[model samples]
Target chain A: MRTARKPLTAAGLLWGVVILTAVLACSILAGLSTGGGEGGLRELLFPAAGDGDGTRQILLQVRLPRVLLAALIGGALTVAGAVFQALLRNPLADPFVLGVSGGASIGSVLAVLAGIGGTGAGMAFGLDGRMLFAFLGALGALILIEKIATVDGSMSVYTLLLTGAIFNAFSGALIYFLQSIASLEQLHDIVFSLMGHVPSTGFGTVAVLAIGILAAVLYLFLQARDYNAMTLGEEGATQLGVDVERVKRRTFVLGSLLTGLAVSVAGLVGFIGLVVPHMLRLVLGPDHRMLIPCSFLGGASFLVLADLLARTVILPGELPVGVITALVGGPFFLYLLRTRRTGHEFR
Target chain B: MRPALILLAILSAACSNNLQEQKPDPVSPKDGLRLVVVSPSAAEMLAELGMLERIVGIGDFVSRPPGLNRLPRVGPYNAPNIEKVLDLRADILVTVRSEAARASNARLRDLGVEVLELDTSHWEGTRQALRTLGDRLDLGESAGEILASLDEAMTTIRQRAEGSPSPKVLFVVGRDPLYVAGPGSHIDAMIQTAGGTNIAADSDSPYQLVSLETMLQRLPEVIIDTSDNGPDALRGRLPGPWDTWDFLPAVRENRVFWIDPDLLVIPGIRLPAMTERMGRLIHPEIFGDPVEADFEPSPEPGPTETTIEDSP
Candidate 1:
């Protein structure tokens, strides 16, 4: 079993969390202060007596919810990535790679195809039809993947990986089929929904997402020690008295929940799950306890800043936030691979 | 001397036969030209030209001029079936210019099909396309009459709209992520012709995925929304979704319109009609309020053919 290169000191962990918290706060501030609207940091900082209500509405109602949604989605995907990496003991495992995102996408696309996309009959829990369908799709995918990968009550990581790969391919084909049958208007809606842009939502949506994401992250964090052990392989973790099966199942469910929430709200914002966790792991060692919390804060900061750039890059015209993240993450990920000789640090 | 005379007579007969063969076929009205029209705009134009009978096959998207509904569908404009086009024995395949359909168009052309790639996205393009279609189909007189009517209708609307206050109008094409009809689009042209200022005139492209906050800040006085096409989508003037932004002048004044995209979105021989509908939206006082039929999709089949909406 691989041990931590450096001892886990409380002070070091506390400082990492503190620094990330500060970074996240700064990112949120920057996101709030900047946008395509007339309001800016200067306008926000000094409210003139003649300032129109439009500027205030733009700042509060428009930018705030979007910023909060980005932060929540970013944090959730990043934490989910870190947990999946630990449980699967694979450096490349992410929500997208594990097929959870594909399932949620299928559900969302199906909802859109059913003409329930922006305006349909409201469902239970104040959730829109699309979001509800997406969450259900994620849950269904998680169960299906778990059932298929498990043989004789024991799940093999290799089998799980293969199942995920196959499922994702199937999902992609199915989405294309759905697109082919849709009308021109529906096609446009589907294409835009699939491309990762944070929807302009209300505070109610932000609050719901926050509660769900926080609850899931906390539950996953409690299993951090089991995740750390599982990284040493299933047999090794068993030898260490860890309930490997239980931990794996819990991680998969919780991680998928995080992915579903993010994707349901913000379409498919790629790279946050894959890039942020790996980045945090490289800097903070392969320890799950520190990595989980730090990943949440760091990922939130990264996405908030990415979203800020996405909205501001073209002035009046906005590029999808997914485009910005992938553009930045793809190159950074390649650089990490090239420079990190051995690649054992990830394991 | 008899042999020389016989040779000259044979040479003269041969020359006469050659001249007869080289003479062009006589051009006539409604000359037999088997056309396969894939573009809805082209189909609409052909119907107006009284040449719908010449169309052998229709495309998947051509729902208008219900007389063509009985014809075989050759597939969508971008991915037309080459076999179907050949089987129909089409003399000309009329379609809109699409980058995605380039390969299929090339294959069809190579297989001895005359492809007429028309542009109906703008007013000038529409006029040029109509003229070209007329000349090719030998229906120049019919096409000319349609053009005159279109120009006369447009001139009347423009003249009536003149000296009116140009209300700031927002033409929303999509809501989720907020796509808008910016400057240079057909909608933009209609808004200007209707004497309404386009809120998105400064945007870079004809169709742009715009910033919602920025768009809202512009404070449009009139909002024409054709974004929702779902079966359950609320129709007519209603603040279905725009209720969230009640501060918007459009929402506050109950000027948020939820009309069928077919009424104003599609550019074709319907430009003058579409522009008049737009005038109604921008200046309800002059052009009159948009009636219930304006918010509904064009009725299909049976040839009732409700092309223009009622004036309220």
Candidate 2:
């Protein structure tokens, strides 16, 4: 049976890109313009004194790197979510749904407690002990989760989600135990490491992160067609000459890489993975090709705006961007759940 | 013109007279003032002023001045029991200014109890708070006497500490995540006043999470651990963590001393005593050894339950 094509044609894709770019541009310009006290966002962005002034230096040197990091993390997370949902054939699957974030956090938190990465000051450029440990943790979790949930080379989605959820709980409790024994100074580092904020790093560090995320995301985008085929059920995709196992494995590893990078670089800003892709799916339809790129752009816009709110809403003190995303995403998730029918399965 | 000049002279004399009258009285009378004190340190300050009897309601943490534990408990320092506070007919409720007490402070005011928030987070603030609390209780002259002595003691310490090599000191508040009293902290000020440099003095925060490696590299000559597992509390035991880093000067020379949290941790009226004790720890040659009050006597205790500070 030939179904109808959705509205997301080339022209629609162009329009979406244009609008997202506009949103991003507007957000970047306005990020430092809110809150009217001393060191107001406006003064920081456009210092009345010359560009070499401290305010401008802070805006460019400190805030800009973090802002860019947030956008990159958001895009990476959403793209990973889209890939996971397609490969697992589960709409509920998000980048963090498989407990990858939990694993990454444990490694980083332990490193933070051990005085790795040079205190709370964020000194990692590439493959620092914290990031390396986090990568190892994420890789470890991926392998373990895959091993436990697979039977006869056929992975059960139900077991996969359940294993991921339980692993997350176990990791969380482990972090708490570690936290209890850490020094009071180490306690703050542990809590903040898990609390999830975009730490301000230099351009060299940002470029390294940008390249890693971009490479992983582009690799996933290349597998979009295989994802589209897998959406036609495992047996159906196999009959259509697609290697279902290979696709699943590749998606799993690539998605895990994206998630590991997100957590290790910026801590644990969750809900972007769940919220951004789900929203994009509704608006852009299930076609993997357009959805992948769109999720990246849309997610970038969403997080930049959310981070702007996180930084400005409290004035001087910042609410965690994770809190902002969850506040917005949790209710939206509930609305989606209530509106959708149960037990039908997406395929 | 003569009349105008005479009127202007009279006006100037009257203004001068008004200014003199407005000058604060050296001693204010405490006329049976009813009070409810929420902060333990604030209660200690009042007790120093001999106004502890006036505190009809006291916070849960106020376990000082040897007595006054018998007063009606008004709950924790942050959230005082509104019913108990009002029930005691307290004219004023004095508390430390804190984020934890924001809602409680407002709620007490709503219940018709007068509230005064005093900032006693630092040594400077402690003196001002005591004076303010004294003024609140109408006992300014008594607080003034205590302030004068505190000022004199600090001045003496500062003078003697001058021209001497001030060794860097690390004041550890906890372990695992390693909380330290950083720059702008009350403990940092005490370290400076006691003729030592805080190793974390340049850090932006008052109390901050720090790296153990950084602390080791800084090589503090003196280490003050305020963790509860001290020799007094732990049957003549040393904290297990400090021994791991033998390379540290503090650990090597055995300058790491454990002190009572109540005396040092809480910034209060007891700063003079705390300062003197810290001085002895940092510069024993100049200021002499610290006194340790034995809380528990061991059955066959070696060397009479004395603290390391008191050891000759």
Candidate 3:
């Protein structure tokens, strides 16, 4: 048992480092290659006065920050997904299964329609009150769903997922009603916000997100052994001396918090959270010790690459980052669903 | 003297009675046609020409020209409520852009309603539509006068700005996918007429998606975003996506201005006023001389000495 554990732990750590390196390299390369062919390797390395030119500035300032933000959000969301799935012992669960994204969207639309985002103080913080309200809404939804899904002093994954779907539908109906009353300008703002364009926020905001996500990941990782045991059914894990309830409560709060933060910042960047954790699981096996950290790095790299393609696919015009993710991830998800029928029930 | 006063009083009474009996009602056209205008601007123009009473129905979106509220709404411009139009027994249906509402227009025509399709998406098109409408409505003289004044305004702006250096302007219509007005759009034409060059005017399409990279390369002197109503849609608000490039003149001088899209984009009688505003925005030095007409002019007296307001 000791010999088996040592290799698994080393392999997990190695893969984690490898993915982090790959993501960093891709982000830098993508930052340089965006804009046009003008920002080649020579321009990236030297950046001469003439060579640095207008195109280089676009690649660095506009595209670079956008790519970095995508990476941070993607990583954060996927890690949250892995944690939620392990906590519930359900492979079908995704980051948005808690209805955080839906709540955030409603709050964003309200902020935009109210015209609060246009105030001077609203603009100074880089993220307008729209984003703040979205975060608060996300937190509210997480708490509401958690309370409803819990019965007889314990949480049920089945109840949680069902309630989440219902809450999402309710939020969608509310958004449509808001759209009907919104002016044309407000409609534009709401549509774009929900469609998930990562507007270039300040580095400070990105750093805050990165720190928040990383802290959550680290906390979850420390509970990795408990997660492994919880996979064997809650009663069985409790019989094995694991404090199942304490683990469940902590994971739910931390996991949902990370998910809410990501959704608030990036809108609903679909598929990454749902698919990345599963894909990492296939490679690293069912161990949360290996799957959780590796999923974060892999997801970040995937999104950074996706965002690069979104910007450069049509020069002088960009496709929304959400479009890029769904276009690629949708087909892959279908393939996974079709080929893999393990029927390994998750909770 | 008493006999003269009694004779004068008897004559005044007879004259006053005759005047009350005549009433001086303005005659309707030879056809006595009842029209329904589906476009808001058309409704406003028709109302301005003393033809509001002739309009038996209007589109639901027609909010301007306050008296129109009492008129029956016939759905939106693109999809007119056919039942309402038919029920009102409208003889003629006025709409903008025949192609925009082809099915609705065809349906109206099929129902024996005369559909007058007007293309008022540009200045010249709007002028032509006005003249055609006037000819059809038998208000040719008023239409001719309105067209003449519009011409006078355009000529004044052209002469003032013809020799001046035109500023390179970027007219952003939307931000997140970054849409700009290209050649053939009314906004593009207005920019050209107002002695400013639209950077996106060279695009093949009427409206094209421009990249932030291209915008930075162009480095326009003025950035005017007619994205929406407020300052958030303006050029300098958070600089969200464009903050990275400090070399942009618009960024450096904070020359980004936001105008109401309705005022700048909608093609109507407001084009002259729109161009004048653009001229002032682009080259304030030359066309800064403000021309203020009483937008609410005193009511003119009709031929028989009745106020135009009282004609109906």
Candidate 4:
């Protein structure tokens, strides 16, 4: 019985990793197909010779960066969502659910309208001021909501969820007010920016984003056992030797960082965070050990596929990937809510 | 003789007092009177007339004309703060005509402010608006000079492209569903004046989507995409849908152009330069000789060049 169980467990882990790898590989292949040229997987994996050819230049410069960025954002958001859901013991938790995304959006909109991103003596580092402001805004929202939701050194699931909802509404109103004051051209930028279209950032920037996401995910995964115990109330987890407060604080900070970094790169890509975690939870069960790792893979694959559809559905013109995720995630979420047999309420 | 001279002096003084007591015309204010101006074009015109110092309040969006940005903003063109205008105790309020600002204009008039509405929707409208503004501000001679110079520049372009064949042009204002300016739009008028036929001119709406099927059928000679604010918009970034129709004359001949929408679409005193640019884009061969340069054309071979193989 022990020998049989050992192989079965090993097979399960291997199969899960294989499935994730397949999804990532497929998405990369599909992304390359949308480039619309003679080049295929060879050109996708390896850069073409420097012949100064226009087609190769477009493929190498534009589509590659966009696809890579989408994958990074998708992976980061999903991992963040998985971590939050585990920490809060709520399946419905997402990066945006805590108001971080909304606050970041407002900050970015303000920066764009004020024309803060351009290089000059006015702003240091020549970074898009909107992106920096968005980071700060996310941090601000996280701290404020954490303070309100935490009572007696313990985070309440109910308060955290409620605060997030109210803050989301407030941020939406703030964005609209900023829009009213924006110029016609600035309005276009703000609208597109909010719709979650990942523009082509350089490979260097993508590398930086990848490193940030990986570090956050690794940190969260290290405390996976603590998250598993927290699923059984904070008092119970503490009795079982889990430092519930420390885990909650660390998770919130790390998760918010991942969220802010993703938003700064890819705007607000909704549904990936909410949908990916739940979908992974259904397969992997409530264990964060498996859930967190699988969520990253699932989210990355889902966004890559969604982005492929976004680019190809209205071919030549692109639909914002956020719209596609909402269309797909909304019904799936409702289905999950409807088919619940257990008495466990989602926070 | 002394009594007669004293009586004449008293009569002359009475006549001068009567002239001072008479109220100025409400519609047209007297020249050299202090007034606050709103609207960037109006502010620019004021500066052009050497009357910037007279402007006490300017619109929020008026950043151009050098010194106007420093002035107190009276709000945007659509909604100028009437309270500020009244508080400044200005003579008149000038504004541009748009559907959104109609109510604001009515309110301004109701508040006893002399409101002059200018329709700066097209080149002709822009010229007429400038002239009307000049008439209102009592800068008639300067307005006449500016209008005459504008007319001369437009006439020069018209004469240059008089007998040349008009190219079929597609002017895209926005992407996604292919929004283009139709008849009754200033862009359409500019395209016509520049010796090109606007393919979207027959659409019902002023700014409407010209179906992709219709676009493919029309096969325009020149495709001018104003979606981007700069020159590189038409190059490799022509989006995806258009790539499928590489056989179209515009694509095959590398006739696609990208120009700043503000310069071409915005109705202002820059119409002359706008028309000249449009003419060059539509028929560069007519204005100047075509030069052989390496252009990164679309990779997909056009339908005209593609061959179908028979299957056994």
Best by TM-score: 1
Per-model TM values vs. the true structure: 0.89, 0.58, 0.76, 0.67
Instruction: Going through the candidates in order, state the TM-score of chain A alone for each one.
Output: 0.89, 0.87, 0.84, 0.86
C-alpha local distance difference test of each model: 0.78, 0.67, 0.67, 0.66
Measured over all alpha carbons after superposition, the RMSD of each candidate to the real structure, in angstroms, is: 11.5, 15.0, 12.7, 15.8
| DockQ measured for candidate 1 | 0.23
lDDT of 2 by residue, A1-347 (tens): 02556645778777776777787767665654432123446665456755322344445555577678778888888888888788777766775767877887888877776667323233545445677667667767877887998899888887888898899999999898886576544554565567666665668767987888888888887877788788888898899888888887777777777777778767777768778877777766777777788888778778878877775564323466788888887787667557644512554
* DockQ winner: 1
Tell me the DockQ of each model, to 2 decimals: 0.23, 0.03, 0.14, 0.04
A1-347 per-residue lDDT for model 1 (tens digits): 24557766889889999999999999999999989897876766676675545787778788988898899999998998888778766666677767888998988888877767543334345366677677778778878987998899777766887898899999999999987776655666677668799877878878888998999888887887888887778898999999987887788778878888888778888767878888787788877878898989998999999999999888678889989888976776567557654434556
Predicted structure 3, TM vs. truth: 0.76
- For candidate 4, what is the lDDT? 0.66
- Which has the greatest lDDT? 1
Q: Residue by residue across B185-257, what tens digits does model 3's lDDT show? A: 6677788888999887766555655566666678787777655444333322224334456677766765566
DockQ, prediction 4: 0.04
Q: What is the interface RMSD of each candidate, in Å?
A: 21.1, 22.7, 20.2, 21.7
